[model samples]
Target: MKKILIFSASIGNGHNQTAKAMQESLGEQGYSSMIIDTLEYVSPTFHKILLESYMNLLRLSPKMWGKIYHNSERSRLIEINVLMLLANKLKKLINSVKPDAFIATHPFASCMLSVLKGRNNWSIPIYTIITDFTIHPSWINHHIDYYFIAHEQLKYLIDIYREDPEKFKAMGIPIMKKFREPLDKEKLRETFGLKNNQKCILLSGGGLGLGSMEKVLDGLNNIDLPLKTFVLTGKNQKLFRKVSKHTYRHEVVPLPFIDNVHEYLHVADLIVTKSGGLTTAEVLSKQVPMIVHNPLPGQEERNSHFLLNNGCAVHATVSEQLIYFIRELLYNPIKVDHMKQMAKRIAKPNAAEDIARFIMEDMASKAVSKVPLGGE
Candidate 1:
């Protein structure tokens, strides 16, 4: 079996989640894959607090978060130090696993691979999968063999930076296998103790629950719609408890880091979420229309653009607008149908399988090229 090493960081949950999905896909395709958190390999304590603080800042002060994100994108000087550390570690990792190829789902890993390619040559292939629709300069490097971008727009964006148009492939975004599977809407709704006719709006603030979850709930509670709301307060116990206390006539279900997002998506009429690439892709796979609420700046702003352009989702920057949009969407079934159809059209259900097939084919070609002419 071919061996693949998937690298991801815990800065955001999406990167690690994508790595897990890809690992599972490769396993089902008869490939041995290992998923490793790059930050844990470096400094667990620093990464933990840094990741937590990043999420908290995004929730409390998105403008500050945006500024920091933008600054990080431009700081090549600081990146050189990061690149050196990553290069040394990667040299050790590759020497140990001897993977046939390396797949990176995080920007830091991509940058490190670029730096390593210049310093030391690895005969094995290196692939970078952009989890977001937007492209950052850090995600580009001349040494990458293949790039799996979330959209065609990202391909163009990266080509502008890397100056190689042929290296990138717009494979759509990758999502968990469950999102690609079919779920019975009525059955799922009944299982969740929700009425068959009542529209369920699923609200998510990402894995760390970084958005204004309580404020959004309050706004939705004041709305004059007969809709049930499901809030996923991932890793945010305070927000979950506070939202659950609101005794609204319509049922409000508050959860903490649920494993069955596909089930919720199956029964949800609309999804109100921060426009993280992975969540957007999952929602697309489920054929659920979206209302992006308070997207973190930089890549998320670009992610919002992709959904808006595709007619798969709408944007609401404030709580009041979010509630109004929800009310309108729940009332106007035709518009909601249109959005859902657009989302379905864009969903690449076989993305993970497609990527695995490509990698395996490349591996086969390489192995065949190395055969001796007179070998038995």
Candidate 2:
């Protein structure tokens, strides 16, 4: 079996989840793949400092983070510095792993590997997945062999940069294999102990402490509809405890980090979530309409914009808007059905399988033809 090395970052679970999805798909295609958290592996201290600083900034002062995010279009100081720090460690890892190709779910991984491959004359491929609705400049570079984007509309990013358009595969973002399969909603509801008579509203903060779920839950208490709500306070014990202890008008169930996210999604009539790329993709794949809460500046805002423009989600700027959207969507089945249709129309449910097949076929053909590997 051909060996594949995938590099991911821990900025959020999205990056690692993206990498794992690809790994699982590739494994089904008879490939040996492994995922590495490059950020933590390269330097644990730097990883902690970076993640903490980023989380704090987004929580405490999001405008400052937004300014830095936008200014990065004209400058790659952070990416460059990360690339520099990752170069030596990544080189050692690659030499040790000796894989046939490299895959990156994070920009830092791709940028560093692209440069290192050219400089060291490594005969391996480097593929990247841009896991967002919008393509940031940091993810754009000349040396990557191929890019898998979330949508065809984002092809303009490649076209405007004078890169070969064929280098991009707009195959949608790869999601878990389980998400692509058909699920029984009734069974899912039974598994999760959901009430059949009440409306099901699933609220998630996108696996990170990114949104105001407590405030949203408090507002939800005022909704007069009969409801069963599942609050996914993922990996946040404090938040989970608080939400679990809090009283509400309806049955509010709190869940910690769960392995069966797809199941909860399948049983939800409506979803209120922060607009992270992975969660959005998962929600869309399940054909559930969304109410996205106060998105953080930068990519989250961009993701929310894409969802709003696509007609599958409501962008709520504050608690009131979020509550209003929830009430409206809950009572209006016609609008909810329309949004679900739109989501189904745009959802790439076969993204993981298609991407796996494409990579496998491309690699086999390249090997048969003996073409030089690892270049743009």
Candidate 3:
């Protein structure tokens, strides 16, 4: 068994989800893997501040965050300084873990790992998984051995950024195995008390439930189609309570923090969601057409654009537009089917397993191994 260290950040659930997917995949492949929240491990105070500030920006002023994200992309000096600041901490962790390889699901972790590898000239293989459809300059590090991205377009984009195409692989973002497995759609609809004949539309606010669920649901209710609407409020208790009280012409099933999201996704004819990486990947895997709504300004906006450009999804920035799009998609089944077809074409259902196998094969082919699994 080989020991693999996976570093992820908690800015949102997407990065952590990608990290966990890889960890699970590696475990099944008989590898000893550890997942670390890099920010928390390096500095708890910094992690708290970074996480809270990000959430606050997303909740209050997303435009400001967007501006910051764009500006940061050009700040290579600043990025390097941040990396240098964390290099000592990362070095300490690497020395302690003594893992055979490193995998990063977050850009920050990738930068830190790149710095450590460059400074120490470590031979351990470093893989960076871009958990979004777009690539940011911050994610590009010359020291990284391989880059796993969502699509071929992203690979081309990264090539322009890094000037190295050989290091990139268009491995779709890793999702949980359950998402790839088939579920009985009719059984799921029955379990949720939805009508078998009606079309089921799922509205999700990602894991934090961090969007305007009430307004979106209200907009969807205005559509005249006979449909079953499922609202996943995530951890938003207030939104759940408000949705639970509301009655609509269509059946509205209000749920909070569900673990069986894949089942709901399986039964859904279309999904209205914010374009988080993991959620979008899961929806694509389920081959459900998407109406992207209120994507967070930076990566999510890019994710939405990718889906739209690829013909797999539609975008609705407000509730009214959401209603119109839903009406259009529902009334136009052919269009929905087309979107689903595009989704299926791009979906990487076996990404996690593929990544695990690639890492194993690459490690075995290397002349010098770093650390043995479960050994000193």
Candidate 4:
């Protein structure tokens, strides 16, 4: 069996989630794989500082983060220097692992691996998985063998920077296998104590619980509709406690950090979430209409734009607008159905399986080419 190396960073859940999905898929295909957090491997101090700074920036001032992201696009020299600094550590890992192929789910990993592959003259294929809907300039690297993107529009965006259209594949974002499996809505609702007749709205703050859960729940309670809300505060104990104390006109179920999020998504008629890449992909896979709330100003904002442009989601910057959008969707089920249909059109539930199969086929072809014509 061949071994695969997947590198990801822990800045956010999306990157690690994507790596795990690919690992599971490859495992099912009879391959062994390892997933490593790049920053954790390179420098623990740098990783801690970067992760804390990122969370603080997003919470305190998203616009500032946006400015940093935009400025970094033009800071190619600085990015190159950073990659050079980390090249030795990455090269050591590659040598120690001696894997057949490498995959990177984070931009930092991708950039560093690309540089190391070139410097060491390694022949192993290196694939980059773009975790977001939009392609950032920092992700562009000439040494990458393949670029897996979330959508076709992103391919076009990357083409402006690198003119190799064939190198790009719009495979959608790889999500957990559970999301791809068929879910029985009635059974899920019953298991979760949700009423079948009432509309269910799932309010998620992503893995870190970054959004305003209490305020959103309060606004949702004001909507004069017969609805049941399932709130996932996601490791934010304070937010969970605050939401649990409040009583609303409708039924409110508050949960903190669940492993079975897909089951909750299965029972929901609609979702209210901040537009993180993985969350948006999961919602789209479930074909549930979404109300995006307070997306952080960088990739989340771009993810929001993609969803809104595609008509599968509505953006709400404030509590009143969120309530209004919920009422609108609930009162008009036709519109909700339309959004669901749009989601179904764009959803790629089998992306991880597809990617795994593609890599296996490519490897087989290369192996066959190396064989002699007459078995000499």
Candidate 5:
């Protein structure tokens, strides 16, 4: 079996989740793959400093992080320095892993691999899965072979490779196998202990739980609809404990970190979420309308923009807006259905499999081309 190495940094849940999804698909296609959290594994110090600092910025000064994110895109200094920091370590890791091909699910990893590929002239075939609706220039690197993007909408917008359309495959973001289809709603609801008669709302912030979950629930408390809100506080133990203990006007079910998030998503009538790219893709896969709440400045903000522009989701910057959007979607089944249809139009349920298949096919084609005229 061909060996594959996936580079995933645990900045947030998206990169690791995307990596696992791709790994699963690749494994099913008869490839051996291992995921490496290079930041944590290769350089634990950098992981805590950089990744923790990023989390703190998002939590404390999101607007500042936004400014830094956009401003840094205009300059390659940050990328260069980051590359320097990781290059030697990554080189050692690559030599150790000795994989046939490698994949990057995080921009940091992609950047490092791209620069190292050019610097060291090591061509083992590398690919990047841009796990967002919008493309940041940081993810761009000439040495990267193929770019798997969420859609064709921003293909031209990736300033560096506008001419190389062939390199950009709108294969969608790799979500897990379970998100391939929204399960039977009634049956799933019954299985999950949800009432059939009441409207259901699914609330989430990616795995880190960046959004103000308590405030969102407070806003929902004002709405008089017979609603059952299932709050998924992914990896947010504090939020889980708080929401689990708190009483609400509507039946509030606080969920711990779950592997089967897709199931609750399918059971939900309306979803209020902070738009991380992977979470957005998962919600879209479930064909549920979403209310994007105060997304953290950089990619999440852009992801929110894509969702709203695509007509599958509504945006909310404050509690009042959240309540309003929730009420609007609750009473408006026609609009909800329209949003679902729009989601269906864009969501690539088989994205993980498609990406894996694309990689293997490309590898096979290259192998065939390299064979001597009649000599294997």
Candidate 6:
């Protein structure tokens, strides 16, 4: 059994979830995989400060976040130094695991892997999975063996970032194998205690559950729609309780940290969510249309554009717009059908298998090259 190391951070839930999903994916394909949260391995104080500061900035001044994203592109020296420190720490972890290859789901992981390749002469192949549809300059690095992009348009974007075009493989987003299998909508609805025929709308604020869930739920109260609503307040106990206490006559379910996300996706006809890469990918895979709320500055904005252009989702800038968008989606069957069809066409059902196979083949070729021919 070949061992593989998957690295991610805790700043957001998507990164960690992606790492876990990839592990499961590899297992189904008959490969052994392990996940490590690099943040936990490091000093807790440093991780706490960094994560809190980032979330505070995202919540308070997103424009500043946007500027940082823009600056990351041009400030090569700064990025390189940060990468050096990250690489040194990750190098120790990699040496212990001695993984056949490294797979990174976060941009920082890619940056650090590049540094290891540059400064430490590390030769293990590293594959960076670009979780979002739009490519950022920070995600582009010279030493990565390959890039698994969300779509073909991003391949062109990477060209502008100066990466060789041949390195990109349009493998869609890596999701759990459970999502790839066809779901029984009626059975899923029953599992979640949802009505058989009534419309179900799933509202999620990504893994942090950072968005204004209560505010969005309150706004929905203003609209006179007859759909059942489900809000996934992930690891956000305060938001969960606040939303749960609300006395809405309509069927509203408030869940905290559910393991069966695909079941919820299967039952939802319309999903209102933040434009995180993982959320958008899952929604797309389930063929559920989306209404997006406030997205984070850089990658989230790029994801929003891709979904909008692809007819998989509609954007809502403010609370009112989100409410109105839900109303429209609930009432219009034709538009809903159109969005669902578009989503099905774009969903990559075999992404995990493709990625696993890619890694296995790369490892095999490398091993073969080291053989001594005509050994006595």
lDDT of 6 by residue, 120-140 (tens): 556677888888777777677
lDDT of 2 by residue, 1-69 (tens): 688899999997899999989999999999999999988988889899999999889878989888888
For residue 369, give model 6's deviation from the true position in Å.
Answer: 7.7
Local distance difference test, per candidate? Answer: 0.78, 0.83, 0.84, 0.82, 0.82, 0.76
Model 4 has a clash total of 0
Q: Model 4 residue 9 lDDT?
A: 96
Evaluate model 1: give its lDDT: 0.78
lDDT of 1 by residue, 260-342 (tens): 99899888888888888888888888889899887788779889999999998999977778888888898898999999899
Query: TM-scores for all candidates?
Result: 0.91, 0.93, 0.93, 0.94, 0.92, 0.90
Best-performing candidate as measured by lDDT: 3
Clashes of each: 0, 0, 0, 0, 0, 0
lDDT of 1 at 118: 59
- C-alpha root-mean-square deviation, candidate 4: 4.0
RMSD of each: 4.0, 2.7, 2.8, 4.0, 3.9, 3.9
lDDT of 5 by residue, 243-341 (tens): 778888888888877888888887788888889999899898988998888788889899998988899999887777778888899888899989999
Cα lDDT tens digits, model 4, 1-376, are: 8888999999899999999999999999998999999988998888898899888888778899988888877775245777768756776666676788888998888888887767766677888888888988777786888888898867668657755888788988899999988888888888888765788988885433434565666677667767888878777788778767878888888888888988888878888888889888888999999999888888889999999999999998877788889889988989998999999998888888988888888777666221111110
- lDDT: worst 10-residue window of model 3: 367-376
Question: Residue 228 deviation, candidate 5, in Å?
Answer: 0.9
Off by over 4 Å in 2: 79-82, 206-212, 368-376
Candidate 4: clashing pairs of residues? none
RMSD (Cα, Å) of candidate 2? 2.7
Model 4, CA-based lDDT = 0.82
